[model samples]
Target: MTSDQYIIQRKVNIVELGATLGNISDACRKLGVSRQHYYDIKQALIEDGIEGLLEKSRRSPRIGNRVAPEIEQRVLDYALEFPTHGQTRVANELKRKGVILSAGGIRSIWLRHSIEKKSLRLKRLERWAAENTNVLTEAQVQALETAKEEKEAHGEIETHHPGFLLGQDTYYVGYIKGVGKIYQQTGIDTFSNVGFAKLYNDKTALTAADFLNDKVLPFFDGFGLSLLRTLTDRGTEYCGKPENHPYQLFMHLNDIEHTKTKVRHPQTNGCTEKLNQTIQEEFYAVSFRKTLYTSLEQLQTDLDAFMDRYNRERTNQGRHCRGRTPMETFIDGIELYQKLVHKGELMH
Candidate 1:
């Protein structure tokens, strides 16, 4: 039973015990309640029935600190209009319109309405716009259109085969005891989950180009697979005017298509970003204190060994290669494609 129901039942039992015992003091002593309290319960039951025995809310009716309905509606409207904005930004926008609210208060409102996440809020707004286009203001209609366009522009990339798309990025591995700050150039095939990494003392265009040429290109070439495209962030190491950047020039010379991610979206190169994180957690973090390396050459050798084990033995739980190691997934995909080609079921 609920606490309120239990409390009411106990009060009724105490009253009943008083009536049966024929002594108020005895009943009060047995029930551990004062005689006056028993009388109060009896009077409440007589006046208002069972509900009178239940506990009532202790909170005041006039909650002065609560947000006004109109202000709350304004907050909701502002959030729907710019679903990508954070709570602070939304609150600031509301304040500019003379609707002052703390960021926490705005977030609380968002939480109550289940619109805290940008994606959910956008979906809600889009649904509302679609259902009530005749009633929406011009500005609201325009905002909905803009949100749709933004969502379309940032859609996920789809890769059909192992060598179709590769993501490359650089990571700064911290300084070692004997070595200065080291950087790692990492690349990963998005479809196969196969990864390549090389450590460098610096993050230069030349280093990036050399890593692609020596490590990544050679490995794929050994498998008789051609890397069609490379994706990287718009960092100076990977992108610039085609005539000036070493990395861009290298891709051009090798007949590989070079694609740079949108200005602020590092997630476009998420595969290599994840590879950098894995190397840091699995290799660098574990090996830094366990092994002593007096030179960069020694560290590079260890890194290469770790990469070999990672590609051959570590089972990738990625969607494309659920239970297979990277090398296994790569080879299997290539063989499948070749078989389809030989049977005249797939085009070149």
Candidate 2:
């Protein structure tokens, strides 16, 4: 029988006995139920009729002590502050800063704030990087062949300076947890072969543009004193979706021209292409160790620190550098650049 039916029957038996037989204990014994159970049924029947004996409301008590909005915002703020970091990493950071919370709680805060899992972007980038990898167009093939022929005829390929020419490409460091091991968009200065990278979660026109505006452009205007050219591949990062790809607009605004390497032959942009691979070997490989990163913000911080050290302190084997760091070379080049400027030969 339903609990409500059973409760009603028991209460009826108790009442019938109390009125006719005058003993609730005797009535409960006759009904094969305890005295306490009978009394409980009696109370429920009087207060709630049949419904009280049924399941009561299962809702939880209102959590007036829920996490504060500002606390959750703090979690999001810290996560953005360290882009390469994941929710778990952010949780640790919060803990380190003495914010007492469970990892799951911190993750919930991230979710509530619409902070997506970093791995999602990494996976998308990995797929795109794989799809576009080494698949050169017919035009690119012909260009490679032409460049090879010219090199054979002249012994050295004609190249140009930073703003005059930039070479763009991608490099890989093993699989990342969220994003598989795919290509990270990279660039090099044709003049000095100095390198930089835009570690994309995936390549979108806007992401590429943002990378250029927020990261690459600043580097050019600052550290790369002689930058006058930007070389790139005709990848979507540069060409397709002009509305989203800010590099085109940026180049137009600065009055700088972007040159693309021959379609299939990255060797035409060999300087930056080579440096992309070198960065994979010299920095990413060492730092990432082929494991998935927990956070992009953390990774960016590490990359920035490494780059600064590389430019200011690390010794290079290239003849152009004479074992000096890129920063040291840049400092020396300033004097030469001023001389060229005085002679009306060089322009910023």
Candidate 3:
């Protein structure tokens, strides 16, 4: 039964129990409900019968908590105008138009109207245009056509072992007093949360290749593992016509397949993006001001120490890992995959 129906039935049971036990106070105490609440239920039953025990919606019709109708309409119009924009961008656009809305509030409206994804929204608009072609303006039809033609890309990569897939990306870690400008190149194992990061004075194709060779490859090699693939964005540092990109050349030499994210879709490389955010909040933001680094070597030294703690000490609460550290999860995944292979249930 629905929760509301269950609650109504429970109230009726409580009233009956009070009558049977010959004590309203005893029934209220046993049911953990206030005596006043028991009386209210009993009175409702006396006046309106069983229908009165049915729970009504608590939502207020004229409540100020609900989004204003005009504001919601403006949000819908803005979303239609920019079909490719995510909730954050939509909320920012509304803010610029003097319609302040939190991302959660905007998402709630989108969910209420079933505008979950850009592609879904575009499809709805296309249907509307098809149905009202005679009434739609020229500009409205053109907007619908453009949205329909836009490609909708969604992808997810699964890793069965630690070296099955790796996601790499670079982030600007800000300029330090003595270190000048710093750029951090990071790589994370998709199956395990194990990550490696190196700070460079500049972000270039050569630096990106060096980070993979000097840090990422060597770390995996120490564990007697080989990376199957590396995923990155189409930044100049990691992409080109393939022959000229140093990072691409490095991957080719190592026998690792290099995969780039879809154009304008950074969520495809979300693993490294999430790692960058974690490092920014947990490491750089907390330690950058507190620690004094006189040279690049010093910063690199501290960064290496932090990476050790991140891999071996910090317990990951991810769904796959539970409370195990990244190293522990990596080892567990390898063991499970090996057992499955031995049982002839999985191919190597």
Candidate 4:
């Protein structure tokens, strides 16, 4: 029962026992309720019978609110027409029809008698496990065997030095309440947990080009690196003929050596992909508690603050600079970069 119901039940029981004992104070002290409350319950019971002393139902007395049957059917029909439209949009549509209802009220009515889709996107393993009795196909078995043998020979991740590799990928930042869906293009340096994100309207070549030119170039330039090997997914944004692709042009301009992950294989860029989860949990989830930004400029400002906190304050898990933040590690890396540059050493 709800707390309200529980309190009323306790008060009613106290009054009943107090009447039997012929002392209100004795029952009030034992029950830890005021004598006024005990007497109130006794008077309620005497006037309206025992039914009045019992807890009343919290469910609204009104039937399905004041919304007419015809209006509710119209809301359902509109929802059916556009499956992607959420409760807020449905409420707005209903308001245009001269029917006023709060979003929560509309959602309650919509959910009461409708089939709803789950919000989460199912992973491949979950889908495969549900469909097949034996989860792994023969092709998957062969690929796993090959990967295991290679890993056994090569050992684990090379966490020894800097400038070894850099990984890149795009992650969707789910649907924002006011702004539509957007992708967060991200990059992670292998040696350090230092990463950056640039929001994109879509996963197009032009947007991908902006990430390469505006975000990636300035970072590499700050560290005085020109020719580093970059890992990326073979999506249309990053691959295709150089003549037709913008990422090709940008990479060439910046003298960046490029490598692509195998088709249908995400594990190749697993480090950066895992970093995407960190971005979502640490930045997006935390920022929602404060103001939610609608414009791109405000969103970028919030992202910059989040990135600063992530790199300067947060600690890495298993790498060498365990206690130090990514920013501190990055500073240490800069010292190494300057020393190399001074010693007349070629660096990538």
> RMSD in angstroms, all models?
19.6, 21.1, 16.1, 16.1
Residue 295 alpha-carbon offset, candidate 2, angstroms: 1.4
lDDT tens string, model 4, 177-250?
45656678888776676777888768877777787678766776777664366788888888889976888887
Ranking by TM-score: 3, 1, 4, 2
Colliding residue pairs in candidate 1: none
TM-score of each model, paired residue for residue: 0.53, 0.48, 0.55, 0.51
lDDT string for model 1 (176-247, tens) is: 545666778889888888889888999989999999888888888888777878888877898778898888
Winner on TM-score between 1 and 3 is 3
User: Which residues of candidate 1, in runs, are more than 4 Å off?
Assistant: 1-156, 339-348
Which should have the higher TM-score, number 1 or number 4?
1
Question: What's the lDDT of the predicted structure labeled candidate 2?
Answer: 0.57
TM-score of 1: 0.53
Residue 310 C-alpha lDDT in model 2: 56
- Among the numbered candidates, top TM-score falls to 3
Ranking by lDDT: 1, 3, 4, 2
